[model samples]
Target: MRALRCPVVELRQYTLHPGQRDVLIDLFDQEFVETQEAVGMTVLGQFRDLDDPDRFVWLRGFDDMPRRADALESFYGGPVWHAHRDRANATMIDSDDVLLLRPASARGGFPAPPGARQAPGEPAASPPSLLLATIWYGHGPFDTPFVEFFERRVRPVLTEAGGEPLAYLRSEHAPNTFPALPVRMNEEVFVWFARFADEGRIDDHLNRLRHSAHWSEEVLPAVSQRWARTPQRLRLAPTERSVLR
Candidate 1:
């Protein structure tokens, strides 16, 4: 298992000025990865929203809460960001209110990137696109039993429905460090991102899952009782340069 170097994570969803997603992805993939990691953060993975052309979703990590402040201060204050921040900001209509997170357990963090973060001008790897489903539970502090239930029950249901579970994560409860860039405060949520072959397959899978006796008899009851609200779902596809693909 790869060590989860970053105990603190940020799930950032950005609403871009129409058709500017690729423009920002180009800047991000070309210039942002190693530069931020050079200071202290890990650029985990970047993705394109298959359902929405104007949305970009990415993850970044830090060793701990304090480190998050130091890393952001350094990277955003550094020359690369200074030179490119305007362009990046220009692409986005909104970038704040990210989900602050950490690994649910020791083994719950992201897999290491295939190689070291790519430098500018390096050829990025081309991996097949996978349908990423992010299900966000409105309440969190999802404990051992809940995680076990998800893996043992919900995951198998999703698998049977043609969705492959990729990662499961819970909200990080650490105090906000860089208040300037705020995460949703006082929220308790766990998120799972899974992969499917296509949108039609996902629709089919959900239908099957709904009709499955086990899902109706046990899974739905457990989930409804645990989660505070209906789980919010996001359909994401990898960008050409995304590592998670």
Candidate 2:
């Protein structure tokens, strides 16, 4: 496969078993929701390995070369990160390595032009877009508070991250999917996509989201204890534009 030149470069690391994924989530959620925003970490994407159980992944970005380099330096070397880094490192198995994702839509944003622009009377063109998805089961009663969080917190954070307000949708309603790693989708999965002016905007949009104020406090409280057991996340860059726009 070709290396995608997505505008948003998602960076992640997957730790192995005997390692507590939820424990890591708990210990790092603050740094995740908070520090990422502060450190100028661009996108804060979360996910579960569909095929590999308990394999969790996170996605975030940087717009330019300097910002990307700076965020990494701050995350790995800053004093604010020391404790969380220690905890995450201590809890994980050695096999895990960080992964990067840049959806095709975003890739179009590279030095390459994102195809052609619309003609004068032609239907408005649908620019390529990418959706970051999180799937987890709704354990009955937790639904109310969770719903509330989705409305009040999650949406705004996503809006801020994207730098554009994207219409939110359900997995079934939106129904856009790529080959996911592997996991049972029983939970109240939430889906949202960010549209770019061109494919390249994807990375810039994500970078802004990591810097958003609401990304952490908005979603972290609702994260359940069992979250570690089912940390599923995936990203899809749609090949065909959905008619919803």
Candidate 3:
């Protein structure tokens, strides 16, 4: 069977109360998954930020802008959210500033199911974790050369150094339909997710990229010329029930 096409995606990062990240994750995994999907949205994956214990990250997708509106309204307005909204809100310190995104092209989205999962308390090498990178552009729509430059020039190096490219995305242009949940507005960005064998492998891959003349001399110049800010890298580990694992 063909995988579902999730055209519009939200990369949500929540800042939780210091000790409440796990509490929220448990509530989310146990109660939120199937319910949200039933309301016309795809619960792509839920993750724990390996680097930040108090931060929770997850992704959800929709068919299009209008569908996203319908799904959000149905899910958040329904009994499930109403019952658990206060509990969920209590765990979070901040829930706004979400990145609204879409696949860069037809070939630029997530991989199919049977994703690998890292066993709890196990060493990093036991199972691979995903590396999610958010590359911020200067402003507005991304230019063709910038996309081509990354794919043609930067991607090969990452692949050669043990990175498995998953998705290439750009910020979505549609206005936020769910006013209750604010998305980062008018932001220009490109995001990519890749898989690596372990944290060490990601480190090694980045080290190689930095040492290589191609990255430092060629790619750096192009990136510097266009990027609005330094790229943000989030090293994430899939939760036990995460589909993207």
Candidate 4:
């Protein structure tokens, strides 16, 4: 299947109860994937946070704001979620850390995976590539200048340093259509996703960026001045059925 184009996306991070991450992942992979897609949404990827065992991270996309509202209404009110909601809710301590975003530019969106996603009931295997999700919190929305700066300066540096840029996104100011599931409001963020071969590659990539004087002396200072706080970095391993890996 061709990858769906998701102009709007959600980066959802759930803090789960200890030892319950796997339980939720299994249920999500089996029950949530196809059902959501049936309702006009794309389950882009699901992952385990390598740094935090109790955290469950996932990405889902929508065609636009109106469609996002419609899809959530259908899936959340439908029979599947109703049947499994309790079990899923039981595993979560918190599920409200969500960021709504849009592609930074015309071409800044996820590409189709090289192969088909693993079928349901197939044994889970270790994914060879690691995904990195980096978020930069800013005082105000990242405007055209910052976006251009990233595309022209920061992105090339990352590519040269061996990270494969998957997507670059900034906050979507659309109102929260579905009130049942609250998203972080009044926040400004810039997020980028990348892939590396493994942990070793990630380390090497970081080392290369750090050693580059242009990055340290030029790009780093400009980025620091624009964002309010330290960026959040997530090291993610794709779940068995994830297409991104």
Identify the candidate with maximal TM-score. Answer: 4
After aligning candidate 2 to the native by TM-score, how far in Å is the CA of 210 from where it should be? 37
Reference-based lDDT, each prediction: 0.79, 0.45, 0.80, 0.90
| Ordered list by lDDT, greatest first | 4, 3, 1, 2
lDDT per residue (tens digit) for residues 152-240 in model 3 = 88778667766657888888878888777899878888888887757888788788877888778877787777677777888888776
lDDT by residue (55-151, candidate 4, tens digit) is 9999999999999999999999999999999999999999999999998877688886667667898854545788999999999879998899898
Residue 134 CA displacement from its true place in model 1, Å: 2.5
For this target, which candidate reaches the highest lDDT against the unseen true structure? Answer: 4
TM-scores for all candidates: the values are: 0.88, 0.40, 0.90, 0.95
Better of 1 and 4 by TM-score: 4
Model 4, C-alpha of 68: deviation from truth (Å): 0.6
Q: Model 4, poorest ten-residue lDDT window? A: 121-130
Cα displacement (angstroms), candidate 3, residue 105, comes to 1.7
Question: Candidate 2 overall Cα lDDT vs. reference?
Answer: 0.45
Error (Å) of candidate 4 at residue 217 is 1.4
Off by over 4 Å in 1: 114-126
**Model 1 scores what on Cα lDDT?**
0.79
In the range 1-245, model 1's lDDT, one tens digit per residue, is 66775688898999999989999999998889878889998877888887789999998889888889999999887899999999999999999849988777665667665665345566655545565656556655688887788878887887776765766788887788988797886787887777666677778877988888988897888888777777777777766656666
Better candidate number, 1 or 2, judged by lDDT: 1
**In terms of TM-score, how similar is model 4 to the real structure?**
0.95
Per-residue lDDT, model 3, residue 222, is: 73
Q: What is the lDDT of residue 11 in candidate 2?
A: 37
